[model samples]
Target: MNNINSGWRSGILEKIQGRLMKVYLLARRFRKHIKDLKNIPRTPRCGLSKQETIINKH
Candidate 1:
Protein backbone atom coordinates (compact mmCIF):
# COMPACT_ATOMS: atom_id res chain seq x y z
CA MET A 1 0.00 0.00 0.00
CA ASN A 2 1.06 3.59 -0.57
CA ASN A 3 0.64 4.39 3.12
CA ILE A 4 3.02 1.60 4.10
CA ASN A 5 5.57 2.79 1.59
CA SER A 6 5.36 6.33 2.92
CA GLY A 7 5.85 5.11 6.47
CA TRP A 8 8.90 3.08 5.47
CA ARG A 9 10.36 6.01 3.60
CA SER A 10 9.81 8.29 6.53
CA GLY A 11 11.58 5.87 8.85
CA ILE A 12 14.60 5.67 6.55
CA LEU A 13 14.64 9.45 6.17
CA GLU A 14 14.58 9.87 9.95
CA LYS A 15 17.54 7.52 10.31
CA ILE A 16 19.50 9.39 7.68
CA GLN A 17 18.68 12.72 9.32
CA GLY A 18 19.83 11.40 12.70
CA ARG A 19 23.15 10.32 11.22
CA LEU A 20 23.59 13.70 9.50
CA MET A 21 22.99 15.51 12.78
CA LYS A 22 25.55 13.36 14.59
CA VAL A 23 28.13 14.01 11.88
CA TYR A 24 27.41 17.73 12.00
CA LEU A 25 27.91 17.79 15.76
CA LEU A 26 31.18 15.85 15.46
CA ALA A 27 32.41 18.17 12.71
CA ARG A 28 31.60 21.19 14.86
CA ARG A 29 33.57 19.75 17.76
CA PHE A 30 36.51 18.91 15.47
CA ARG A 31 36.52 22.43 14.02
CA LYS A 32 36.51 23.92 17.51
CA HIS A 33 39.42 21.71 18.53
CA ILE A 34 41.37 22.76 15.45
CA LYS A 35 40.68 26.42 16.22
CA ASP A 36 41.91 25.94 19.79
CA LEU A 37 45.12 24.43 18.48
CA LYS A 38 45.59 27.27 16.01
CA ASN A 39 45.19 29.84 18.79
CA ILE A 40 48.09 28.33 20.80
CA PRO A 41 51.41 30.11 20.27
CA ARG A 42 54.26 28.03 18.87
CA THR A 43 57.53 27.83 20.79
CA PRO A 44 60.57 29.39 19.14
CA ARG A 45 63.09 26.93 17.71
CA CYS A 46 66.05 28.28 19.61
CA GLY A 47 69.34 26.32 19.43
CA LEU A 48 68.08 24.05 16.66
CA SER A 49 70.46 25.65 14.13
CA LYS A 50 73.45 24.86 16.33
CA GLN A 51 72.30 21.28 16.79
CA GLU A 52 71.83 20.82 13.02
CA THR A 53 75.36 22.04 12.30
CA ILE A 54 76.82 19.76 14.95
CA ILE A 55 75.00 16.77 13.49
CA ASN A 56 75.92 17.59 9.88
CA LYS A 57 79.67 17.51 10.62
CA HIS A 58 79.48 13.74 11.05
Candidate 2:
Protein backbone atom coordinates (compact mmCIF):
# COMPACT_ATOMS: atom_id res chain seq x y z
CA MET A 1 0.00 0.00 0.00
CA ASN A 2 2.80 2.40 0.92
CA ASN A 3 4.61 1.73 -2.34
CA ILE A 4 1.46 2.38 -4.32
CA ASN A 5 0.89 5.64 -2.51
CA SER A 6 4.44 6.82 -3.15
CA GLY A 7 4.15 5.98 -6.79
CA TRP A 8 0.89 7.86 -7.11
CA ARG A 9 2.33 10.88 -5.32
CA SER A 10 5.37 10.92 -7.56
CA GLY A 11 3.16 10.76 -10.64
CA ILE A 12 1.16 13.72 -9.45
CA LEU A 13 4.31 15.67 -8.64
CA GLU A 14 5.72 14.99 -12.09
CA LYS A 15 2.51 16.22 -13.73
CA ILE A 16 2.58 19.40 -11.64
CA GLN A 17 6.22 20.00 -12.48
CA GLY A 18 5.52 19.53 -16.16
CA ARG A 19 2.71 22.07 -16.08
CA LEU A 20 4.83 24.58 -14.15
CA MET A 21 7.66 24.19 -16.67
CA LYS A 22 5.28 24.87 -19.54
CA VAL A 23 3.97 27.99 -17.87
CA TYR A 24 7.50 29.17 -17.11
CA LEU A 25 8.59 28.65 -20.71
CA LEU A 26 5.55 30.48 -22.07
CA ALA A 27 6.16 33.41 -19.70
CA ARG A 28 9.80 33.58 -20.77
CA ARG A 29 8.85 33.66 -24.42
CA PHE A 30 6.22 36.34 -23.81
CA ARG A 31 8.73 38.46 -21.90
CA LYS A 32 11.27 38.11 -24.70
CA HIS A 33 8.66 39.14 -27.25
CA ILE A 34 7.77 42.20 -25.16
CA LYS A 35 11.45 43.11 -24.90
CA ASP A 36 11.86 42.82 -28.67
CA LEU A 37 8.82 45.03 -29.20
CA LYS A 38 10.25 47.66 -26.84
CA ASN A 39 13.59 47.55 -28.66
CA ILE A 40 11.92 48.38 -31.99
CA PRO A 41 11.88 52.05 -32.99
CA ARG A 42 8.59 53.77 -33.55
CA THR A 43 8.54 55.66 -36.83
CA PRO A 44 6.44 58.80 -37.25
CA ARG A 45 3.34 58.32 -39.31
CA CYS A 46 3.08 60.84 -42.14
CA GLY A 47 -0.49 60.59 -43.40
CA LEU A 48 -2.42 58.76 -40.73
CA SER A 49 -5.33 60.49 -38.99
CA LYS A 50 -4.85 61.46 -35.37
CA GLN A 51 -7.48 58.96 -34.26
CA GLU A 52 -5.80 56.18 -36.26
CA THR A 53 -2.39 56.90 -34.79
CA ILE A 54 -3.79 56.99 -31.30
CA ILE A 55 -5.48 53.65 -31.85
CA ASN A 56 -2.26 52.14 -33.18
CA LYS A 57 -0.25 53.35 -30.19
CA HIS A 58 -1.90 50.80 -27.97
Give the candidate number with the greatest TM-score. Answer: 1
Model 2 lDDT tens row, 14-58: 999999999999899777756655544463444235534544564
Per model, how many backbone clashes are there? 0, 0
Best by lDDT: 1
Residue 52 displacement in candidate 1 (angstroms): 26
lDDT of 2: 0.71
Per-candidate TM vs. native?
A: 0.68, 0.66
